[model samples]
Target: MLKLSEIQRPIERELTIFEDKFKESMRSSVPLLDRITHYIVKRKGKQMRPMFVFFSAGSCGEINDATHRGAALVELLHTATLVHDDVVDNANVRRGFFSVNALWKNKVAVLVGDFLLAKGMQLSLANDDFGMLKIVSDAVQQIIEGELLQLEKARRMDIDESIYFEVIRQKTASLIASCCACGAASTGADDATVEQMRQFGEKVGMAFQIKDDLFDFGIDDVGKPLGNDIKEKKLTLPLIHALKQVGKPEKQRIINLVKNHNDDSQKVTEVIAFVKANGGMEYASSQMLAYQQEAFNILTHLPDNAYRHGLEQLVRYTTERNK
Candidate 1:
């Protein structure tokens, strides 16, 4: 029930410092690059990943210079991925704003993404934060692998619940897990504590993605258009579950719609109704709550404090967010 502002209260000052660090790290000499970067910075979404870093650091130990750098590193990598994703998805908007590619075109957006990635690496190398670098680097690899896996599955229309989980775990959860692990590492937390934080983050991330998938079925558009995932032929948990419950012919019908007629509004409406009738949304909601509870259980293992409370609120916020 805690508001986001309340959750951020404990680390308010640290977040300011992290913001300064992030802006400084992203500074560039090229005029176009600077303009685009400034626009990105200006239109940045809630710094959820950096908040994870600072909160996890505070939960394990005191925040320090290393924690600030860790926050910056994650943000930089996250921004890079988002820019690249906009191009890949042909997404014209992000977080309800015009995407980099929408304004500057794909070529500039891709180069800017690459530059951001390099800046992240340089930040880690300059500070000798190899541990942080490794965590983010592994996450980047997993994210790319997940995107490829999802693409492959979409092409074949063969993704099941297990494959769905794997895709979300890698594409979404891995980076959030890295946020917690790197935060704990920055504070010199023991390996056990770092692992615990990572597990907690992974569960929260799972819930986060489920909520996002649910948005695809919503009446009102969030940032992206409704059924955008369906248009892209990406079968999420709801559709996957619905497909499993139906008979072979009905299943094939759904698959055929997804495969051939995904762009058709009427077909998308039919698929959405089919999913609703088959308890797909209910099942996915249950799974999202399950992951949220699992994350809360992990939080119980951490010491009691405001930072721990912040993490708990974050779990709730992730599941409850409308957009």
Candidate 2:
């Protein structure tokens, strides 16, 4: 495994460029919008999608100015989505600061999100690469659809494993797939190489999300509220799996918690304890390892390069970071 510092160095450098482009795209003398966007810009994130695009593109072909621009575009789109997500969730804090919605209210946040999305589209169109435009458009469409799909799945207490996977694929894996595709889109990588990158991204996305669910069950200071998914009455894969394994009484009890919207402060703790006692958390963690391994396996087929090593290190870092 590569050191986290080594894997993050290139990503961090690119993030500076991403922020500059992002701020430039959001250009406005209006204090509110500027303050909002600036607050969001300075609040750092992992930049996984952009790094995925950059590394994959460079490994398969020459990394150039266009590739960097494409990477910036992905980050912009992702940030826009987060702004919108905060509104949708009515969230108070993100990345340890006041959310746009929390600071400025829903309308402002919504409009800012719209502006960000429009700017992202504008940047992608500037490239005159219709292929990339279509790719990003498709990704945006999938992201919206996935959000609605997850919302639709929220009340479903009996959401099956297949349904859970479908939600994961749409809500998380699609963007990751798009990131890898954007990389290949910028390069001479053949269809096989692009497909491999997509596969890797899919597995990585799955691993990333599964670990997130496990973190909800394990970590105390994720910054976001613990088990917000469950509180919102949306049972994730681990919970769904544990529900299936339990007897009727426990299942009904869990269902009642959902039905009542779970008033108790210890609800998450109790749910987590139930999951651990029944092996749901361990099952989720094991599955995360499986997907991470799958991502690493895809790397073996590509010829050795620093980018490839960086990618492997990134894959390892995902699991280790959560651990």
Candidate 3:
């Protein structure tokens, strides 16, 4: 696994430049826009996307200006989407703070989100490279499509497990996969190496997302309120596995809890009991490990180097990360 300290230098430097653009946005003439944008930029996150961009680029050659630029671009794109997402989800809180929409009102939040999206587009185009223009543009479009698909399937109590996974592939994995692939692209890595990094990113992304779902069922590494998926009528993997194995009466009981989303903790507790009795948590945990191992196995095939080691650390962090 790559030491977090080893990568912290570049990641930290990248964040500095990221905050600059964000600050520049704040200096815009619109007072309401600046206020809402500041709310969204507060407490910047782990900067995972930009890190992937640099790390994957390093696999091909020395990290340089293009690397830093790519990192800043993708991370800003990610942050912008996050701001908009909070608005759409009606999510009052994010990153342990009031969401932009909640803090400054949805109108201001939406405008700030649009500003970020425009910046994301400008950031990539500023590269003055056509190939990246195509790649980043397509990724941006795919992100929207993925969100739309997820909204269509939202709150589906019995969403097909296969379909569920596909949704994750589209909604979550695509951006991460693009990070690695784009990193390789920026450095002109050979197709074979680029594809390997792409696949590696994809496997890790899926594993990470599945682990996130498992956390929703019981695990609390991310502090996302355990079992809230069940409470939200979202049929994540753990519950799906239990449903496949449990009796009709029990499944009916679980369904009732979801339908009664506003019910007390007793309602959530009842469904939690049913999941535990059927080994749902165990099932989800095992499945999560399977994906994690699959991610590591992909690492085994990559050329041995610090970059490969960095990727390995990401795999470890996928399941180990805590809020």
- Tell how far residue 170 is off in model 3, in angstroms: 1.5
Write model 2 residue lDDT over 87-128, tens digit each, in one string. 988889988888888888999889998888887778778877
lDDT of 3 by residue, 1-323 (tens): 44556655544665567567555633557677666666556677776777788778876666666666566666666777788888888898888888888877788778777787777667667676455455556667777887776666754555767867777776677778778877877787777877777777777778778888866655466543366776666777777777778778877777877777525666766667677788777877786788788768867766688776676777788777653
Tell how far residue 244 is off in model 1, in angstroms.
Answer: 1.0
Candidate 1 on 40-151: residue-level lDDT in tens? Answer: 9999889999999999999999999999999999999999999999999999999889999999999999999999999999999999999889989999999999999999
Which parts of model 1 have CA positions greater than 4 angstroms off?
221-225
Model 1, C-alpha of 211: deviation from truth (Å): 1.1
lDDT of 3: 0.70
**lDDT of model 1 at position 208:** 95
In model 2, the runs with Cα more than 4 Å from the true position are: 1-3, 10-15, 29-31, 219-225
Comparison by TM-score, 1 against 3, better one: 1
38 in model 1: Cα distance from truth in Å? 0.8
- Weakest ten-residue segment in model 3 by summed lDDT: 217-226
